[model samples]
Target: MLADALGQVPYFSAREVEALVAAWNKPITLRRGEYLVQHGQVERNLYFVKSGLLRIYYPTETEEICVGFAYAPNVVCSFPSFVHGTPSEYCIQALRQSELLGISKNDFAALLELLPNIARFWREELEKVLVGRIDREIDLLLAEPERRLERLLRRSPHIFQLVPKKYIASYLRMTPETLSRLR
Candidate 1:
Protein backbone atom coordinates (compact mmCIF):
# COMPACT_ATOMS: atom_id res chain seq x y z
CA MET A 1 0.00 0.00 0.00
CA LEU A 2 2.78 2.40 0.92
CA ALA A 3 4.70 1.38 -2.19
CA ASP A 4 1.71 2.15 -4.38
CA ALA A 5 1.22 5.46 -2.60
CA LEU A 6 4.80 6.41 -3.43
CA GLY A 7 4.92 4.89 -6.90
CA GLN A 8 4.65 8.23 -8.66
CA VAL A 9 8.27 8.94 -7.82
CA PRO A 10 10.25 6.68 -10.15
CA TYR A 11 13.55 6.75 -8.31
CA PHE A 12 12.52 4.28 -5.64
CA SER A 13 13.03 0.60 -6.29
CA ALA A 14 10.56 -1.80 -4.67
CA ARG A 15 13.12 -3.09 -2.20
CA GLU A 16 14.29 0.40 -1.26
CA VAL A 17 10.74 1.59 -0.92
CA GLU A 18 9.91 -1.33 1.33
CA ALA A 19 12.94 -0.57 3.43
CA LEU A 20 11.84 3.06 3.74
CA VAL A 21 8.32 2.01 4.71
CA ALA A 22 9.73 -0.34 7.33
CA ALA A 23 11.58 2.57 8.89
CA TRP A 24 8.35 4.17 10.01
CA ASN A 25 7.88 3.57 13.72
CA LYS A 26 4.14 3.14 13.72
CA PRO A 27 0.81 4.09 12.20
CA ILE A 28 -1.25 6.79 13.86
CA THR A 29 -5.01 7.06 13.63
CA LEU A 30 -6.48 10.53 13.94
CA ARG A 31 -10.05 11.66 14.25
CA ARG A 32 -11.59 14.87 12.99
CA GLY A 33 -10.32 18.02 14.75
CA GLU A 34 -7.28 16.18 16.06
CA TYR A 35 -4.00 17.89 15.50
CA LEU A 36 -1.06 15.86 14.32
CA VAL A 37 1.18 18.84 14.94
CA GLN A 38 0.17 22.16 16.41
CA HIS A 39 1.65 25.51 15.59
CA GLY A 40 4.76 26.39 17.64
CA GLN A 41 5.53 22.74 18.41
CA VAL A 42 8.55 20.96 17.04
CA GLU A 43 7.57 18.70 14.16
CA ARG A 44 8.88 15.27 15.13
CA ASN A 45 7.66 13.12 12.30
CA LEU A 46 6.71 13.19 8.65
CA TYR A 47 3.16 12.03 8.11
CA PHE A 48 2.49 9.83 5.09
CA VAL A 49 -1.26 9.91 4.63
CA LYS A 50 -2.87 6.50 4.36
CA SER A 51 -6.36 7.96 4.29
CA GLY A 52 -8.35 11.13 4.99
CA LEU A 53 -7.81 14.87 4.82
CA LEU A 54 -5.42 17.22 6.60
CA ARG A 55 -5.55 20.99 6.70
CA ILE A 56 -2.38 22.98 7.06
CA TYR A 57 -3.31 26.17 8.79
CA TYR A 58 -1.89 28.99 10.83
CA PRO A 59 -3.36 31.43 13.30
CA THR A 60 -3.28 35.16 12.92
CA GLU A 61 -3.87 37.57 15.78
CA THR A 62 -7.59 37.49 15.07
CA GLU A 63 -8.17 34.58 12.74
CA GLU A 64 -7.11 31.14 11.60
CA ILE A 65 -6.05 30.89 7.96
CA CYS A 66 -5.91 27.77 5.89
CA VAL A 67 -2.65 27.55 3.98
CA GLY A 68 -3.12 24.29 2.17
CA PHE A 69 -4.91 20.94 2.19
CA ALA A 70 -3.66 17.38 1.86
CA TYR A 71 -5.59 14.28 0.94
CA ALA A 72 -4.79 10.60 1.22
CA PRO A 73 -1.49 9.49 -0.35
CA ASN A 74 -0.15 12.99 0.34
CA VAL A 75 2.39 14.12 2.88
CA VAL A 76 1.54 16.46 5.76
CA CYS A 77 3.91 18.38 8.01
CA SER A 78 5.63 21.75 8.36
CA PHE A 79 8.42 21.32 5.83
CA PRO A 80 10.71 23.95 7.37
CA SER A 81 10.33 22.46 10.82
CA PHE A 82 10.91 18.94 9.53
CA VAL A 83 14.02 20.06 7.70
CA HIS A 84 15.43 22.45 10.28
CA GLY A 85 14.29 20.96 13.59
CA THR A 86 12.58 24.22 14.46
CA PRO A 87 9.18 24.67 15.99
CA SER A 88 6.45 24.60 13.39
CA GLU A 89 4.73 27.83 12.49
CA TYR A 90 1.86 25.84 11.03
CA CYS A 91 -0.71 23.38 12.32
CA ILE A 92 -1.57 20.07 10.72
CA GLN A 93 -5.03 18.89 11.64
CA ALA A 94 -6.96 15.89 10.49
CA LEU A 95 -10.16 16.88 8.73
CA ARG A 96 -11.60 13.39 9.15
CA GLN A 97 -10.74 9.91 10.30
CA SER A 98 -7.20 9.45 9.08
CA GLU A 99 -4.34 6.96 9.15
CA LEU A 100 -0.72 8.05 8.71
CA LEU A 101 2.56 6.20 8.58
CA GLY A 102 4.78 8.20 10.91
CA ILE A 103 8.44 8.38 10.05
CA SER A 104 10.62 10.05 12.61
CA LYS A 105 13.37 12.47 11.62
CA ASN A 106 16.04 10.02 12.74
CA ASP A 107 14.60 7.19 10.73
CA PHE A 108 14.22 9.39 7.67
CA ALA A 109 17.82 10.49 7.92
CA ALA A 110 18.95 6.89 8.29
CA LEU A 111 16.97 5.86 5.23
CA LEU A 112 18.66 8.59 3.21
CA GLU A 113 21.99 7.37 4.49
CA LEU A 114 21.30 3.81 3.47
CA LEU A 115 19.64 4.55 0.17
CA PRO A 116 20.86 7.68 -1.53
CA ASN A 117 18.35 7.30 -4.35
CA ILE A 118 15.61 8.07 -1.86
CA ALA A 119 17.22 11.48 -1.41
CA ARG A 120 16.69 12.25 -5.09
CA PHE A 121 13.03 11.33 -4.84
CA TRP A 122 12.62 13.44 -1.71
CA ARG A 123 14.26 16.42 -3.43
CA GLU A 124 11.96 16.07 -6.40
CA GLU A 125 8.91 15.97 -4.18
CA LEU A 126 10.06 19.05 -2.28
CA GLU A 127 10.74 20.87 -5.54
CA LYS A 128 7.26 20.09 -6.78
CA VAL A 129 5.77 21.44 -3.56
CA LEU A 130 7.89 24.57 -3.74
CA VAL A 131 6.84 25.24 -7.29
CA GLY A 132 3.20 24.90 -6.31
CA ARG A 133 3.68 27.33 -3.47
CA ILE A 134 5.34 29.84 -5.74
CA ASP A 135 2.54 29.57 -8.26
CA ARG A 136 -0.10 30.01 -5.59
CA GLU A 137 1.67 33.11 -4.26
CA ILE A 138 1.86 34.59 -7.71
CA ASP A 139 -1.80 33.89 -8.36
CA LEU A 140 -2.83 35.43 -5.06
CA LEU A 141 -0.93 38.60 -5.91
CA LEU A 142 -1.94 39.02 -9.56
CA ALA A 143 -5.33 37.34 -9.96
CA GLU A 144 -8.77 38.42 -8.88
CA PRO A 145 -10.85 36.05 -6.80
CA GLU A 146 -12.80 34.76 -9.80
CA ARG A 147 -9.63 34.23 -11.82
CA ARG A 148 -7.99 32.52 -8.89
CA LEU A 149 -11.01 30.29 -8.46
CA GLU A 150 -10.95 29.43 -12.15
CA ARG A 151 -7.24 28.61 -12.04
CA LEU A 152 -7.69 26.50 -8.93
CA LEU A 153 -10.58 24.67 -10.53
CA ARG A 154 -8.53 24.02 -13.64
CA ARG A 155 -5.62 22.70 -11.56
CA SER A 156 -7.61 20.77 -8.99
CA PRO A 157 -11.22 20.30 -9.91
CA HIS A 158 -13.48 18.57 -7.36
CA ILE A 159 -11.36 20.09 -4.56
CA PHE A 160 -14.40 22.11 -3.53
CA GLN A 161 -16.39 18.89 -3.18
CA LEU A 162 -13.70 17.28 -1.07
CA VAL A 163 -12.67 20.29 1.06
CA PRO A 164 -14.75 22.89 2.85
CA LYS A 165 -15.40 26.15 1.05
CA LYS A 166 -14.17 28.30 3.94
CA TYR A 167 -10.81 26.59 3.96
CA ILE A 168 -10.51 26.81 0.21
CA ALA A 169 -11.36 30.49 0.35
CA SER A 170 -8.80 31.07 3.04
CA TYR A 171 -6.16 29.25 1.02
CA LEU A 172 -6.97 31.40 -1.94
CA ARG A 173 -6.73 34.52 0.25
CA MET A 174 -10.35 35.44 -0.32
CA THR A 175 -13.37 35.79 1.93
CA PRO A 176 -15.76 32.85 2.01
CA GLU A 177 -18.54 35.13 0.80
CA THR A 178 -16.35 36.33 -2.03
CA LEU A 179 -15.58 32.79 -3.13
CA SER A 180 -19.26 31.97 -2.99
CA ARG A 181 -20.08 35.04 -5.01
CA LEU A 182 -17.45 34.14 -7.59
CA ARG A 183 -18.75 30.59 -7.84
Candidate 2:
Protein backbone atom coordinates (compact mmCIF):
# COMPACT_ATOMS: atom_id res chain seq x y z
CA MET A 1 0.00 0.00 0.00
CA LEU A 2 2.86 2.36 0.82
CA ALA A 3 4.41 1.50 -2.49
CA ASP A 4 1.11 2.12 -4.26
CA ALA A 5 0.77 5.56 -2.69
CA LEU A 6 4.33 6.46 -3.50
CA GLY A 7 4.05 5.01 -6.98
CA GLN A 8 1.47 7.67 -7.82
CA VAL A 9 4.17 10.28 -7.63
CA PRO A 10 5.98 11.32 -10.76
CA TYR A 11 9.55 9.99 -10.98
CA PHE A 12 9.05 7.80 -7.92
CA SER A 13 10.76 4.55 -8.78
CA ALA A 14 11.11 1.20 -7.04
CA ARG A 15 14.40 2.42 -5.61
CA GLU A 16 12.58 5.33 -4.01
CA VAL A 17 10.03 2.98 -2.50
CA GLU A 18 12.84 0.89 -1.01
CA ALA A 19 14.36 4.01 0.49
CA LEU A 20 11.00 5.06 1.95
CA VAL A 21 10.32 1.65 3.45
CA ALA A 22 13.83 1.52 4.88
CA ALA A 23 13.39 4.93 6.48
CA TRP A 24 9.94 4.21 7.85
CA ASN A 25 10.51 0.58 8.75
CA LYS A 26 9.03 1.01 12.22
CA PRO A 27 5.71 -0.82 12.52
CA ILE A 28 2.89 0.52 14.62
CA THR A 29 -0.55 -0.85 15.40
CA LEU A 30 -3.67 0.71 16.84
CA ARG A 31 -6.96 -0.80 17.86
CA ARG A 32 -10.26 0.95 17.43
CA GLY A 33 -10.56 4.26 19.34
CA GLU A 34 -6.82 4.37 20.02
CA TYR A 35 -5.11 7.65 19.31
CA LEU A 36 -2.19 7.94 16.93
CA VAL A 37 -1.49 11.53 17.99
CA GLN A 38 -3.55 12.83 20.82
CA HIS A 39 -4.57 16.43 20.89
CA GLY A 40 -1.95 18.81 22.33
CA GLN A 41 0.86 16.31 21.80
CA VAL A 42 3.80 17.20 19.65
CA GLU A 43 3.57 14.83 16.69
CA ARG A 44 7.08 14.01 15.58
CA ASN A 45 6.29 11.20 13.20
CA LEU A 46 4.79 10.75 9.75
CA TYR A 47 2.52 7.75 9.36
CA PHE A 48 1.70 5.60 6.34
CA VAL A 49 -1.51 3.64 6.73
CA LYS A 50 -1.15 0.09 5.49
CA SER A 51 -4.70 -0.91 6.39
CA GLY A 52 -7.75 0.13 8.39
CA LEU A 53 -9.26 3.53 9.03
CA LEU A 54 -8.65 6.73 11.02
CA ARG A 55 -10.43 9.99 11.71
CA ILE A 56 -8.85 13.36 12.43
CA TYR A 57 -11.08 15.36 14.73
CA TYR A 58 -10.91 18.53 16.73
CA PRO A 59 -12.16 18.41 20.27
CA THR A 60 -14.18 21.25 21.66
CA GLU A 61 -15.76 21.89 25.04
CA THR A 62 -18.79 19.86 24.03
CA GLU A 63 -17.88 17.72 21.07
CA GLU A 64 -15.30 16.34 18.67
CA ILE A 65 -15.58 17.81 15.20
CA CYS A 66 -14.41 15.66 12.34
CA VAL A 67 -11.85 17.27 10.06
CA GLY A 68 -10.58 14.50 7.81
CA PHE A 69 -9.92 10.79 7.44
CA ALA A 70 -7.18 8.41 6.39
CA TYR A 71 -7.44 4.82 5.28
CA ALA A 72 -5.49 2.09 3.53
CA PRO A 73 -2.51 3.13 1.43
CA ASN A 74 -2.75 6.72 2.68
CA VAL A 75 -0.21 8.95 4.37
CA VAL A 76 -1.51 10.85 7.39
CA CYS A 77 0.02 12.97 10.14
CA SER A 78 -0.56 16.06 12.19
CA PHE A 79 0.94 18.13 9.42
CA PRO A 80 1.31 21.40 11.31
CA SER A 81 2.93 19.60 14.21
CA PHE A 82 5.11 17.46 11.98
CA VAL A 83 6.34 20.47 10.07
CA HIS A 84 6.71 23.04 12.85
CA GLY A 85 7.39 20.94 15.97
CA THR A 86 4.16 22.16 17.51
CA PRO A 87 1.29 20.55 19.32
CA SER A 88 -1.34 18.88 17.15
CA GLU A 89 -4.76 20.51 16.96
CA TYR A 90 -6.60 17.26 16.23
CA CYS A 91 -6.74 13.76 17.60
CA ILE A 92 -5.95 11.10 15.04
CA GLN A 93 -7.82 8.00 16.18
CA ALA A 94 -8.16 4.62 14.62
CA LEU A 95 -11.73 3.81 13.63
CA ARG A 96 -10.72 0.19 13.11
CA GLN A 97 -7.71 -1.99 13.86
CA SER A 98 -4.97 -0.27 11.94
CA GLU A 99 -1.52 -1.29 10.74
CA LEU A 100 0.89 1.54 10.04
CA LEU A 101 4.49 2.46 9.28
CA GLY A 102 5.97 5.44 11.08
CA ILE A 103 9.06 7.51 10.47
CA SER A 104 10.34 10.20 12.77
CA LYS A 105 10.88 13.73 11.57
CA ASN A 106 14.65 13.34 11.79
CA ASP A 107 14.63 10.21 9.67
CA PHE A 108 12.28 11.73 7.12
CA ALA A 109 14.47 14.78 6.88
CA ALA A 110 17.46 12.59 6.24
CA LEU A 111 15.58 10.74 3.54
CA LEU A 112 14.57 14.04 1.91
CA GLU A 113 18.23 15.03 1.78
CA LEU A 114 19.27 11.63 0.48
CA LEU A 115 16.67 11.35 -2.26
CA PRO A 116 15.59 14.13 -4.58
CA ASN A 117 12.64 12.23 -5.99
CA ILE A 118 11.19 11.76 -2.51
CA ALA A 119 11.50 15.46 -1.86
CA ARG A 120 9.64 16.24 -5.06
CA PHE A 121 7.00 13.71 -4.18
CA TRP A 122 6.59 15.20 -0.71
CA ARG A 123 6.17 18.71 -2.15
CA GLU A 124 3.49 17.52 -4.53
CA GLU A 125 1.64 15.75 -1.75
CA LEU A 126 1.71 18.90 0.35
CA GLU A 127 0.36 20.89 -2.56
CA LYS A 128 -2.49 18.45 -2.98
CA VAL A 129 -3.35 18.67 0.71
CA LEU A 130 -3.42 22.44 0.49
CA VAL A 131 -5.70 22.37 -2.51
CA GLY A 132 -7.96 19.81 -0.88
CA ARG A 133 -8.34 21.99 2.18
CA ILE A 134 -9.26 24.96 0.03
CA ASP A 135 -11.77 22.90 -1.87
CA ARG A 136 -13.32 21.64 1.35
CA GLU A 137 -13.56 25.19 2.65
CA ILE A 138 -15.43 26.17 -0.46
CA ASP A 139 -17.73 23.23 -0.10
CA LEU A 140 -18.54 24.16 3.47
CA LEU A 141 -19.33 27.72 2.47
CA LEU A 142 -22.33 26.57 0.49
CA ALA A 143 -25.52 27.24 2.43
CA GLU A 144 -27.39 24.12 1.37
CA PRO A 145 -26.68 20.76 2.95
CA GLU A 146 -27.64 18.91 -0.18
CA ARG A 147 -25.04 20.78 -2.18
CA ARG A 148 -22.37 19.99 0.38
CA LEU A 149 -23.35 16.32 0.33
CA GLU A 150 -23.43 16.32 -3.41
CA ARG A 151 -19.96 17.83 -3.76
CA LEU A 152 -18.49 15.38 -1.26
CA LEU A 153 -20.15 12.43 -2.93
CA ARG A 154 -18.84 13.57 -6.28
CA ARG A 155 -15.29 14.11 -5.07
CA SER A 156 -14.73 11.35 -2.54
CA PRO A 157 -17.51 8.81 -2.46
CA HIS A 158 -14.96 6.40 -0.99
CA ILE A 159 -15.17 8.28 2.31
CA PHE A 160 -18.43 6.43 2.86
CA GLN A 161 -16.46 3.21 2.86
CA LEU A 162 -13.66 4.43 5.12
CA VAL A 163 -15.64 5.82 8.05
CA PRO A 164 -18.90 5.32 9.88
CA LYS A 165 -22.04 7.36 9.30
CA LYS A 166 -21.72 9.57 12.37
CA TYR A 167 -18.20 10.68 11.63
CA ILE A 168 -19.12 11.20 8.01
CA ALA A 169 -21.97 13.44 9.11
CA SER A 170 -19.64 15.44 11.35
CA TYR A 171 -17.12 15.76 8.56
CA LEU A 172 -19.87 17.12 6.37
CA ARG A 173 -20.81 19.57 9.13
CA MET A 174 -24.23 18.03 9.53
CA THR A 175 -26.06 15.86 11.97
CA PRO A 176 -26.38 12.13 11.39
CA GLU A 177 -30.13 12.49 10.97
CA THR A 178 -29.69 15.25 8.46
CA LEU A 179 -27.20 13.19 6.49
CA SER A 180 -29.57 10.27 6.50
CA ARG A 181 -32.45 12.46 5.39
CA LEU A 182 -30.37 13.85 2.57
CA ARG A 183 -29.25 10.40 1.50
Which residue pairs show backbone clashes in model 2?
Answer: none
Clashes of 1: 0
Question: What is model 1's C-alpha RMSD?
Answer: 1.5
Off by over 4 Å in 2: 8-10
Error of 2 at 129 (Å): 0.7
RMSD to the true structure for each prediction, in A, is: 1.5, 1.3
For model 1, the run of ten residues with the poorest summed lDDT = 3-12
lDDT by residue (1-183, candidate 2, tens digit) is 677777776688889988887788789999998999998999999999999899999999998999999988888998889889989998999999999999999999998999999898888888999899999999899989899999999999887876799998999999999999999
> In each prediction, how many residue pairs overlap at the backbone (N, C-alpha, C within less than 3 A)?
0, 0
Per-candidate local distance difference test: 0.84, 0.90
State, as a TM-score between 0 and 1, how close model 2 is to the true structure: 0.95
- 104 Cα displacement, candidate 2 (Å): 0.8
lDDT of 1 by residue, 1-183 (tens): 677876666666777778877886479999999988988999878888888998998988987888888887887778889889899999889888888888888988888788878888777888999898887887788657888888889888978888988899998889999998888
